[model samples]
Target: MSLPVHLVPALDGVVVGSTVTVEGDEAHHAVAVRRLRVGESVVLTDGAGTSVTAEVASTGKRVFTAVAADVRRVAAPAPAVVVVQALPKGDRGELAVEVLTEVGVARVVPWAAARSVAVWKGERAAKSLAKWRSTAREAAKQARRPWFPEVDELASTADVVAMLSTASLAVVLHEEASVPLASLALPADGPLVVVVGPEGGLTEEEVAAFTAAGASSVRLGAEVLRTSTAGVAAVAALLARTPRWG
Candidate 1:
């Protein structure tokens, strides 16, 4: 449908065919940024699966109204891909999150690797998390994704291993590994978590820890990739191999 689209926080009990008012930031975006006019169509998403296609009925400074044309409930991709990325130096981590979000990753975890140059400690950790969260939200909107990927707080190797232990398939990217990522067969259902190390790569202890947690240490390719690039590349490869995204 040819309409200006925006995502908003969901209101309770709102359903298909219901006429509703768009308020707050979304309304401002529609009225100011998009310059939407009465009779123009727009799509409003709740970012929790529901997207409502509507035509604008009125527009004002504080509110905008629309008549719902259709509502669609989108199901998240199967075998949800979660990237546990080691915090890269400078803005590379931020860039990695943005790229992964665009690549349709379901969730992201910031890992503090043994050799990580960028550290997220104390209040800095909070700020970093917030930054990544904002990046994910913006990327989701720009990519027209119905749902937003979560940006988790910085975690240590042990913490990440514990988290991924619950996944159906958890793989750690290691340069020395002989098993190719494509060779590792993953379950069609359940989650897939890929842990990527820092520029210096994962320490021997970290690799052993992940392997002990049921994660297979797999090599991405013959050539080594940087910390930020590995997670996104591995995720894309996995997604292509999976039945759902393939």
Candidate 2:
């Protein structure tokens, strides 16, 4: 099995034989929960493309120290994917974020779609956003990703249009679209954006606005998918055709 991975604030200048210390909640989980001890191997990453393989040297009440044995830096994948997911009711939002992060999405944008049933207001909005971000962080670690996906703040249709104006490829996941996702030619490099509507589906105006902003409306397949899983499925399909997954 792969060694347990812990996220650090920074991995810059980390070298073999150097000691790195982990503290706070991360260390507590390692020490108290995982029972990490001396001589055990682990991996530490900053989640921005740097990772180190290390062996535990010591443990404390709420902290642990490890000696770096190897360091690796990965280049960010080309043609990063950005998914704009409309809010789903209940805990489905967290599910979407978790799967998207595991699927290698570069960023997840929570969209306040017109037909969405869930509303993020005031404190609830902050908490929900935090939940999505926390979910992404945990999922990334579970997937052993050196780079974590970002969870963007709630956005409106207009906001999404402006955001994807420069994207090399953009697609709106509309069930009624004439084109299939597989039919589109994906860019080998640059930013790519995918827009997934809410449980109630997209408003006509919203679809038009996104299409006018350079996004092509495309259907994943003949069958409909839930709001929570549509983005993950679409992203998997798109990435399969890209070098990142090829």
Candidate 3:
């Protein structure tokens, strides 16, 4: 039978037959939120690809104990999918990060495109990036992801191009493009980076720069998608085509 899953980042390096105590946020979650009692079994994850099955030994207001019953190191999806998304205005960026995390993206790069409505600069940039990272962490836990995806700081179009150049395959989504995303043949291994432009889309010069860096322009479908939805759609399509999840 499948065991109950309870994601906790502090369970790293825990082995089967070892006894560990859950504290802080996790302790509160188990005792107050989940209302877990002694002798109940639950799965715990460290958000770094480590997972363990444990039985509750004791419960308290601030502390909880569990005896590890089994442990396994989960493998991440192959051909890591990285989403380079242009910053959208308002809460759109936050929504993008949360959905993409649930969609199993490996990394998120916040791009400051020329046509982007939202501009993250100075202290606002740092604070926004921190918020995105926190969102990613919480989303990963909610989705029960074995590994937490990273949320990078704001980057320029050129910086994004430089990073995508190192990947096995890099795709830039453009609605006006001739090539369809489904037509492209994905690599069996290595990394794939998908670049989604802002709501207004990329400038002619930005597209030229990415193409010059060996990034192929592809179209998702006939309908144009919002910046918040594009990355998640592309990731879902890629995952469906690849055997990474299997």
Candidate 4:
């Protein structure tokens, strides 16, 4: 099995034979839950492209120390994929975030689309955003990703348009679109934006606005997919065409 990976703070300047401490709840989970013991190996990542392979050296009640055996730094994947996911009703939002992170999306931005069934307000908004962030973190760990995806604060349609306007390549998934996603040529570098509408789907105005801002409207296939899965499917299709997936 692959070594278990844990998220940690920055590991810059760390070298072989250096000792690093895994502490607090993270360490507790490793020692008490995973039962990580001395001499076993584990991977620790800063979630910003650096990872370390270490051998567990000692354990305490709420902390553990490891001797770093090797360190690796990965360049950020290109082109960076940013998914703008419309808020879905119920817990599907978390599901969407989890899958997008697992699929290697660089960032996931929750969009308040015109046809969204859910509303984020006050405490609910704060809680929902937190849940999405937490979901992304855990999903990244589960996927054994050294570079975790960022979950941005909820965005408005206008905000999304402005964001995509600056992207090197942008595509909006629409069931009504004539263009196929696979037919589009993805850029080798820079940002790639993918927009997935909510359960009720994107309004004509929203589609027009995004397209006007340089995003190409495209269809994944004949069958429609849930907002929770559409972004993941579209991203997989896009990545397969890029060297990032190879």
* Candidate 1 backbone collisions, by pair: none
Residues 184-227, candidate 2: write the lDDT tens digits: 98776868899999999998999889989999999988899999
- In angstroms, the error of model 3 at 158 is 2.3
Instruction: Give the residue spans of candidate 4 off by over 4 A.
Output: none
Model 3 gets an lDDT of: 0.88
Q: Rank the candidates by lDDT, best first.
A: 4, 2, 3, 1
Model 1 ranges with Cα > 4 A deviation:
1-3
TM-score for predicted model 2 compared with the true structure: 0.98
Please, what are the lDDT tens digits per residue for candidate 3 over residues 203-234? 99999999889899999999999999999999
State the TM-score for model 4: 0.97
Q: What is the C-alpha RMSD of each candidate to the true structure, in Å?
A: 1.9, 0.9, 2.2, 1.1
Off by more than 4 A, model 2: none
**Which lDDT tens digits does candidate 4 get at residues 43-105?**
999999989999999999899999999999988988899999999999999999999999999
What's the true lDDT of residue 76 in model 3?
Answer: 78
Badly placed stretches (over 4 Å) of model 3 are: 1-13
- 1 against 3, candidate with superior TM-score: 1
Cα lDDT for residue 139, candidate 3: 86
Quote the positional error of residue 23 for candidate 4 in Å.
1.4
- Tell me, by TM-score, which candidate is best: 2
Q: For candidate 2, give the lDDT of residue 28.
A: 97
